[model samples]
Target: MGMFERTASVFDDAMVLDEEYQPDKIRERDEELEQYRQALQPIIDNRPLSNIFVYGKTGTGKTVATRYMIDHLQEDAEHYDDVALSITWVGCENLSSSYQVAVALVNELRSSDHQISTTGHSQQAVFNMLYTELDKIGGTVLIVLDEIDNIGSDDDILYGLPRARANGYIEDARPLVIGISNDFQFKENLSPKVRDTLCEAEILFPPYDATELNSILYPRAEKAFYDDVLADDVVPLCSAFAAQDTGSARQALRLLYLAGKRVADNGETNVTGDHVRGAKEELHQSKVIEGMQKLTTQGHAVLLTLASHTANSETPVRTRDLYDRYKTVTEKIDADTIVERRVRAHLSDLTMLGLVTVHERNEGLNAGRYHEYELSVQLDSVLEVLSEEQRFDDIVEIVKQQVHGMDRT
Candidate 1:
């Protein structure tokens, strides 16, 4: 037998657990689906188009539910003789500004050969190009912007696209925006005019509870796994773990998938709670490492400072002390030092990333409250990642020395 010989596996249809897979029916989201269907009902009735804003946390079935409703809406609209519908979906996770998003949408609507460059166009020029493409498609055009919050506050496209017909940017196309976001603050921070124009029908998808996750996971497992492969406690354990963490159906499915993969890799037949727990830890560590790897150089410097203090058993240190140590680390590497306020910002970001924890200390009325920061992750993990960079070698050694000195003390 060859080294890469095939082996018997448990997965029957692993794609069922994939993030991009759209199930024929979306379970546990009937209420959201009904609201979504009504939001699109105007297009079927040949009435004026309505812009929709969808809000939810990650893995709450927002994108899948929207895709499901869009598929059904297109099928239903086929019955009407006068209704002509065109749909364009663009994921804005990587596109950070309105300009980038506009370029993305324009390319999405255009054919492969006619696609415009992502750069070199003015904001208005890109908007014009988008308007032209929409006009070419004509009729009711639905533009779905997924992860729309990545655009931040640069929302000119959101304001202009929804009112394109009224603004005479496009005569033939009645284009409406469908903005999907996981951030609730993005909606609140939108300019009133843009919010009013883009959010005619707002739909919210709440996170899935354990029961809902179970209802979703069982059918998927039935299709994804072979008979007798999953132990009785596998699905429930995965669901409960995900529910307690983020209430994400996607996370639950991912846990189950990873658990089965672990069993398959170990040449085992049954997946149990133990497998689920192991998979959860693997997933978590993978995420932490990935998050750490994506940090800016200054962010890594800030983390290394914290790690050094942690090694010295001196953590839960305030920003002032951290700044002094951080400046020392940056200087050792000949990197420019940022202001104390900016270091605080980096710490704030690290806290959000689950790499650091902060505690607010309240003093008497004479003294104002302050925050102390500490490494929330394993010190060795942070050091391992930071050690990958050659520039940080000197500082990594210093952190190791701190650990050794503490051991001797």
Candidate 2:
């Protein structure tokens, strides 16, 4: 009794549910793993390493599984004396072009004092330096470039790295390039010579199903919360919602983690369906907020117009009607007046951004075909986002008044 203790906690280890947590075993990826293993077999055999390209949607265990297998490859290769393996893993997202990537890899291999600047070298000079660094290692190198498509159309590295030894660029080292991407079309757009070498063995990871997501989340939940903290229905609800969204295992885990946090913060036991729903709303709000931050001035105006219509009615708003609202909002906010055609285009862009939903309506005879737009997010949330921008605050109040009737169809 001398020492006071805190209240009972809900979490055992929250980081287990984090995005960066690499599980010792990957669930629902057995066949993918086997394919991955075969692709990397050349490296283990001390033969010429084959280039690999892995394609998968986000949260499909591509990065984690690759890291897992490569880690094992590094560990197992230690027993063999002939195989001199060096791994350079580059996240191409941070490197914009082939030149930057070359400079980055070259710097990555050097000691701190010997590093080069991010600029000040021609692309060829940087390539030369990178090859020099690779030759110094004088071994078989596996270059794992994650999100390789982030380099945009600059495909020099794609063409250069695979043929570095044959082209007399790297005299001693043999480089094996592995490209990973979430965008499938990026590979299709590659130059043929670049494509043939980098696309040696392509592995596609499909999105997870509800059952698979549930299977993936259970182990994480077991490790994240106390046995009695989570209700029976929590996992199923999270899995179903994520499966509905994109069949993403990461989304399911994040939902569970967020819901658990919500319950614990409220000092409640047994995370219920209410908590799960609350978590979903919070996540959706945050996602919309992030997406909104990236919109242009006209984009925001178009979105606000659609949101105004959606909040006021039970029915969807037509393209022409939505354009009128957009013009009104732009005028009130003292913004530029865009044409109806531009406004219609903005609606399509908004739909693509997932900020708005659209449906094609075939009108009987004279009305012809038209599209309708609706806000995909809650009205109050979108309004809140708009209010944060001082320029829109005044007009946003008027828009809110227009939405308060809620009787229009």
Candidate 3:
């Protein structure tokens, strides 16, 4: 057979399992959908729109549910003459501040040929341009900002846009800001003024439970695979594993897709629980490597220290001990060493990234308390990623020697 020739496979429509594929209807989200509909009811009633804040963890269907509701809202509004609904959607993942977000909004609202440059405009100038665009649309407008937490604490746009009418920024357009974020703390950290104006309607989307995930995966699996191609336990195993890890529907679907792909690659007809387990490991290693690759040089040094100790079975090592090893690694690389306090901060970052786990210990008032850290990932995985960087070759070798010496002793 030619290299690209078709072979025996299981997938009938693999794209159904993709992240961008929106199911005809969102599953197991009636409660959230109802709440969302209620939040958007004012627009249908010809009343002023309420600013809404949506909170949920990643893969909890926040974006998908929002799109679904907006679609329905737009269709329903057409029956009424008064409601001239216009929608603008912007992903804020790469936009870091209110200024950048405002600039992006202007570009999104403008025609391709009329779009403004991202720079060279003052903040007030950008706001004026955004207001002008909104006025031109001149109706009940829904501005959807996904991953809004990326704008961080600079929330001038969040505060300004929602209150545009009251602040006399615009007259013809009634704009409602709907901000979606995966970080729980983003809402809490907003300025009080911004909180009051932007979060007029707050909706929370909880992560999916195992049963919910099972419901979501079954249909996608049926569409993605041929008849009797998935073992009975395959979907259940994927759902259970994802629920235990993050309760993410996206993860569950990905697990199912990977399992089926593995079976198809092996020239087999059935995707088994074993294939699911193997796929889970592959996803985990991929996640670890991706996370590690995004780290800074100092972050890598701190992680390498933890990984080396982990390989020697010496973890749950104290902060001071880890700091000593971290300093040694930095010195060998001819990089300036940061203070121990800063080292602790890097460890905290690693902990947040799920690469390291930390525990607090107290041995009485005199001894006070301190934290101990260890690699939460497989040592082999960490070593594999670090080995790819030429700067870490000498450090990786030292780590191997330490492990070998410990084994001999």
Candidate 4:
């Protein structure tokens, strides 16, 4: 075969590892799908439909499962004249409020050439427009709002859609809402009225365990890679690492994809355990950077303190030490300084993000206990990611010099 004749010596189709690729079959989520089916059956029957609230951590098959079940539902509903199912799928991540969501929906349903501007209307007016558009669809409309927690505290869409028919806002359509959220506390933040309606049938999708992730990746490995492209134990190793990291099937697939790509690019015939190791580290660094991109000024500052210490020989650094370094960091960056107490809270947030590990130490019960924290990730990864933020560039440079100077000392 010519050197460049084939796109890959390994992958038959790499899309099987893609995040957007829907598997022909969903693995390890049979029970969750069954429960989702029960929650959805009423809509197929043209009965009063229950609004759904689904909660799960990232990459746990919540979105995929929802899409899979609804695909089957929509396909089945085609046979019935009474069941006119119109599915409106919205990702609420970028559309942060009820107003924005309503306008987006209105535009989605409107004639393409006649779409209205997204702003300049009152929230109620935008909602009225949404109701008008839904009435036009005139069916059992299942609105799947993924990342529904993006609305923060103002979940007017949830509160309004469930009651749209009864309140006479939407005359012809019976609207059912399916809200999928990754944020665990989002439902708790909803007002009781919104919560009761939106969470009428709640489904929680748990993270996948090691065995489950292995099961998920095995078939994809078969489809994506040529026969025997992956060396022995590579799939299991990917599964184990992902299970330990986040128990996310998506993460496992990504590791496989990255490793396969590495082997292909390097003209290697086999994807090995070493390739998986490198891929996992690359994925970890990317995830940490992505997570850091979401942090606030204070979050970045507190993390910098930990990274700065880790750059030096110090680790399992005390909270007081973190606060002290954080104070210096905030001053250098010209960012608004947060109090030590608030820095403690930011430390907790950083800990939750898995950027750092925390340990509680008791002062032998004679004095009050305090906490210690260390960077859970590599200091190099932290500095690289934070360097992307312009305000933090100066600080990262300072830390780079600090580490270099420490080395010389």
Among the numbered candidates, top TM-score falls to 2
Candidate 2 residues lying further than 4 Å off, grouped into runs, are: 1-8, 305-328, 351-377, 397-409
Which tens-of-lDDT digit does each residue in 42-102 have in candidate 4? 9877677888889999999999999999999999999988889888888878988988888
Rank order by lDDT, top first? 1, 3, 4, 2
Better of 2 and 3 by lDDT: 3
Per-residue C-alpha lDDT of model 2 across residues 155-182, encoded as one tens digit per residue: 9999998898998888889898889998
- lDDT of candidate 3 at residue 149, scale 0 to 100: 97
TM-score of each predicted structure versus truth: 0.84, 0.87, 0.85, 0.81
Among all windows of ten consecutive residues in candidate 2, which has the lowest summed lDDT?
Answer: 400-409
Model 1 alpha-carbon drift over 4 Å, by segment: 294-331, 335-376, 395-409
Off by over 4 Å in 3: 1-3, 302-329, 337-380, 395-409
Check candidate 2 and list the clashing pairs. Answer: none
lDDT of each: 0.91, 0.86, 0.90, 0.87
lDDT of 1 at 119: 79
The alpha-carbon lDDT assigned to residue 5 of candidate 3 equals 75
**Candidate 1: worst 10 consecutive residues by lDDT?**
361-370
Deviation from native of the Cα of residue 85 in model 1, angstroms: 1.1
